[model samples]
Target: MSETYYLHLNVSRFELSLNGSLGQSVNITNGSDPNAANIYPDISYSLLTVLLLIMIATVAGNGIVLIAFCASRRLKTPFNYYICNLALADFLVGIIAMPGFIVYNLFNEVWPAGTALCTIWMYFDWHMTFESAINLAAVSLDRYWSVRWPVSYKRHTSVKRTILILLATWLYMHIAFFPGYLYDRIVNVYGEHDCFWDLVMNRRFCTAVAVLGYYIPLSVMVFCNWSIGSMVVKRTNATAQDPDVAKKYAEGETRLTLAKDKARRQRQPLITLAMITVCAVICWAPWVIYFTIAPHYPTALPDILITVGYWMCYLNSTINPYLYIATSDDFRGAIRDLFCRRSGQTLSGAFSMIISAAPKRTSLETSVRRAS
Candidate 1:
């Protein structure tokens, strides 16, 4: 039972809501006047159920990635450090964004959470997303530097520099959003005054941030990946030309083939990153296009597209751990340890048995070179 309001639109009048009812109506009338309504009968439970599963998987998966990283000392390294940040961003988004989105879906897209929650949701949603994008871009730069100039990379890419970069990324996002949070207010155009991230002041702010926070960083990541990938390809091709590079050495040989094997060992991580990039593009491209174009034209398709993009983006969190395990040997080992410890496997005992038995197998060349 909600009150209905008739809207007058220059020569056409439309009923926006039905009286004594909490929902809008689809029975639009246009006899010398037209009215718009929220067809209440159109609510779909199927979609709601799907959203629930997505939320659960997304949050749980990302949560595990974060927890595993935090608890595992063996996983600690400069490379894993940035990955840890990326996981944090995605995990935070899952916690902050997914729950609210599920609620909104359950409630028929009607936001009952007052202005504060709405603001917080918008902030968290945008912040964590931006953080993920920039962190990935930072990671690309790190990998590029590490491979492109290994010696110099070691000199500059210390733990301190990594931390500073991560901190700066967060700080920059916060500062950029400060103005919008201060002056913006969600306008409830749908009658129930559902709080949302409204286009305040001008859509220019949104456009600006979207480019700076997402597009620009994404571009940077692409560039870095391209450069590093090219270097890897060139090095690998050159190695193919080097008769010794591909020759199988005796297991007892005291020479390190670490450099020669670097690309092969790193293939999985590169594949994982490539997959992530594809997912990001698929998930966010539509939303980015919608946001960029929506200000000029408002339509149901744009809104629907944006919703689709949002869920797709949300899926990233859960997929990261699986991707890591599938891509990186180190990450898989960490997962193995985590599972082993939990499954009645001897706490320190199981790990000790595994560790004391045989060290990770390395070619004789690699072992000797690293020792030297």
Candidate 2:
């Protein structure tokens, strides 16, 4: 996955790695020509364990997001619907993609799962990862639009509109980039026991995949975040100059400290989406670079780096919900409702419990109070 078609969805057979601990490298015929394909043998059990944990986290975290959206009416906004779409993608990656990949990597000798299932795994693995980036872009773009034209955005936005956007995104990703996967399927015939893909033909298609999945989405998110951030700063400054408040502040020495704090706060935007973009760059950029340039350059990046590059995307999925909770009131309230409602811990319930615990006034005390 790392050295070749990104995720190496091209897994045919894993032979002895660089150290050559196994008996010998296995050679397979790519149609007329036979070539030696090396399966990375040093499968770090600790890393695999961590990946398993990430997969679990991805599933649980995204699942919580989905449930939170469903459980609370407060979160039923158009933007939240976009977030829920991303969560659904991350959830699918966890439940369907990660486990399949982890298991595939675990059995380094031969793919126990039938080749047909292997093909399906390959398809889903790329599709889910691509969907995540695309969805993030979509969500960021939606936020930018909402902020840029708040009144119009609110007037036009609806759950139905969000659903349509999501549907379009899903369809576009599937239909536009499908030929790449289909090409791999057609060019690299699967082994009876292995799912190794011959990447010679994939070189042409890898760039397109990288562009659609990584570069374009990355650009979109960055542009959207930048636009929103600029607007936030301008709006904050404009509102802070309110004539009455400015006059009051100008007359007071104590207001100097408050102004400093307010200025610091104003320097930052409310949307922490920039952080998400940073995380995406950290997690996905290496793989994107490799997929785009590796075929032509053939530079051997460290196994650790490659491992981090691919799995870190899963790590992003794991942390996405918590990050949203930090920045989004909707997510926070929805999650609070999800947990509190299930545990019977609503605010009204707390108040009732407090009232019930108070000592009752006796009749004598009541009569004395009345007389007083």
Candidate 3:
């Protein structure tokens, strides 16, 4: 299937054209015509700028979260263990996928890095998505066990189990991408080559993947969220009858709030598993809709809407670190300790000044390297 697609680089607002069949590039352009009955670059540079900001925040925020979780001895718990995995997944995707996307968009959809890089982009995009989905499911189950079987949950939920789940998430996501890579080949179309899963002609196979990769996982996530949420509400209502905890609730106070404050005093993790699930839904709902619906309607509006949907998924990684900081008192204090020692510090200038002040770390220093 030969088709043309455009990628808009946020920094410079350059548009690149791609041959959807070969996953290669033909030429780049400044912008697409908005009113020519096709996809439009009607969105302003300011909006793109905001996206770039969001991307940067996601990378930096997740980076800090990873560092804090790794550095602090007190922050390690069963829930935090899963959160660390989530942060790692988000950080990897942000670093690998976002820059490549910026390059594609800035150059106007032309994938100058060749087919191999295209594979990498596709892999990172799908792999991280799978890991995130599984992580959400795992977190939901974790919460379910915690609330419904509190005693058993305390006995069974351990660092070892968390490790097993994290490993399983990685293994599952990598294996899932293998089939897409094996069967899907890049082809040249309309005088240019592009990379995709070759779903244009093989609608059956594409539909299967959509069902397996997206719809099924979405359904699972929805079920887990609903089950866990219902249990939490019921558990809270039941627990309200207790003497100590109930007395607090009867005094026009939220038990969850007091419980969190008490948990903070002990440096326990504060983010409820329910909150994490909600964030996942908010960040992924748009992209999932776009993915499922785009194949059916290949109109300009769908294309543009799907592009927006892709960015919305990225927003999850960007805002998750902040969520941890806001919800978890321990994380907030760790961050404060990380930078507060430096007097007259400004949040905006901290990263920039650090880069400028310190000697740059070579690629050798970082073991994790992305192909693109």
Candidate 4:
């Protein structure tokens, strides 16, 4: 049901031009015409089913995280403030990016929504992706500062400061992705007006975007995690050597118990953040590298690799809420409380149980530490 358009190039001049449906035209040199080959092969029904499932999971999982944040007052701390923002970004990805991608793939890369929607999709795709990356980086920096300088971090990272940081993160991403929004153009590919960035024409700019958006944030995450790991190891060794600290805690010293409880609370969020960072790198690194290098040798890479890489990026947004449930007991409790409230259990009752159980869990953990 789709139309096909072709651009015949003069071999001597090697100029390629596309005439879009609305009479818009685009010119390029030394890049393969997207319509020149079968860039979008017919997808199998089974693969489509799998992709649909992934899309559903992405939407549902992030939605639960957002719901948990909204329903649980206990989750409203500054640390989780960043987490809520991350969930929001991921939720938007599920709401906007994934469905459009499913449609694009379903129709053999034909953008059914026309030029304006294409432009909007491209903008949201890049903007939300960049926003997620910044959020991850922000979470890493927050953890790094909180762990390395708890008192200072607590003093400075107030609710107002967290809001400012979130605002700054969005502003930075908007500025970073503005060029992509501006440069995106629609071209007729096999009779379908496709919206895409003209970055292939300027490989340098594409490389710059990838380096700034992916590599720098990735490097920051790695350093922060390494620093955090080193601090944990040093602190663990110190605690192991210091018998007085263990004795004080065992003897039910109020100050030491409070300190241990504070550390325990901070530890769970750090672990959750670390898991998210690892997942983000794994999911995003492939596409960033592929995109950055693919422009140089566009035909060298297969279409399936591009598709796989793109889906992998989307996969990151889907897994974060699961990571929270897997890593953080408090998050699990909050989610449970949210669901259990319908069964007549109040948040305070659930929290009280959690508070009452903490001492037993702590005692068991302390015993395990001594045994080790």
Q: Model 1, which residues run further than 4 Å from truth?
A: 1-43, 186-192, 244-263, 299-301, 345-372
Q: Which candidate, 3 or 4, has the higher TM-score?
A: 4
- Residue 97 error, candidate 3, Å: 0.5
Residue-level lDDT of model 4, residues 74-152, one tens digit each, is 8888888898888888888888888888888776666767777887787777788888888888888988998899899
Summing lDDT over every window of 10 consecutive residues in candidate 2, give the lowest-scoring window. Answer: 1-10
Instruction: Compute the lDDT for candidate 4.
Output: 0.78
Rank candidates, lDDT, best first. 4, 2, 1, 3
**Model 2 Cα lDDT, one tens digit per residue, 161-220:** 999999888987886478878887877665666654444457787777777877888899
Cα lDDT tens digits, model 3, 1-372, are: 665555444322233433344544555443574212222334458757976887788889899998888777777878888888888888987888877776666545555566777878877876786787777676667766675677998887788988998898777666655565555644323212244444454444556666656666667767766775676567667776667775555666576687777645532332355466677778778877665555666452445665577777777777777887777877787777766744336755887788899997788765555543
How displaced is residue 269 in candidate 3, in Å?
6.5
Q: Judge candidate 4 at residue 260 and give its lDDT.
A: 74
Q: For model 1, state the Cα shift of residue 195 in Å.
A: 2.3
Report the C-alpha lDDT of model 1 over 1-372, residue by residue, as the tens digit: 565644333211224433444355354564543433332335567986777777677677767777788888877877778878888888778778888877776665666566678778877887788777777787777787787888998887777888898898888777666566555553334334254555533476787777777788889888887887798789878867887654544343444466436646766556767666666666677767776676656663546786777777787766775676677777778877887777855667787887899867669979899999
RMSD of each: 13.4, 10.7, 14.5, 15.0
| TM-scores for candidates 1 onward, in order | 0.75, 0.73, 0.69, 0.77
Name the runs in model 2 displaced over 4 angstroms: 1-45, 196-199, 244-272, 299-304, 345-372
User: lDDT for model 1, on a 0 to 1 scale?
Assistant: 0.70
- Model 4 regions lying over 4 Å from their true place: 1-43, 186-192, 253-262, 343-372
Cα error, residue 327 of model 4, in Å, equals: 1.5
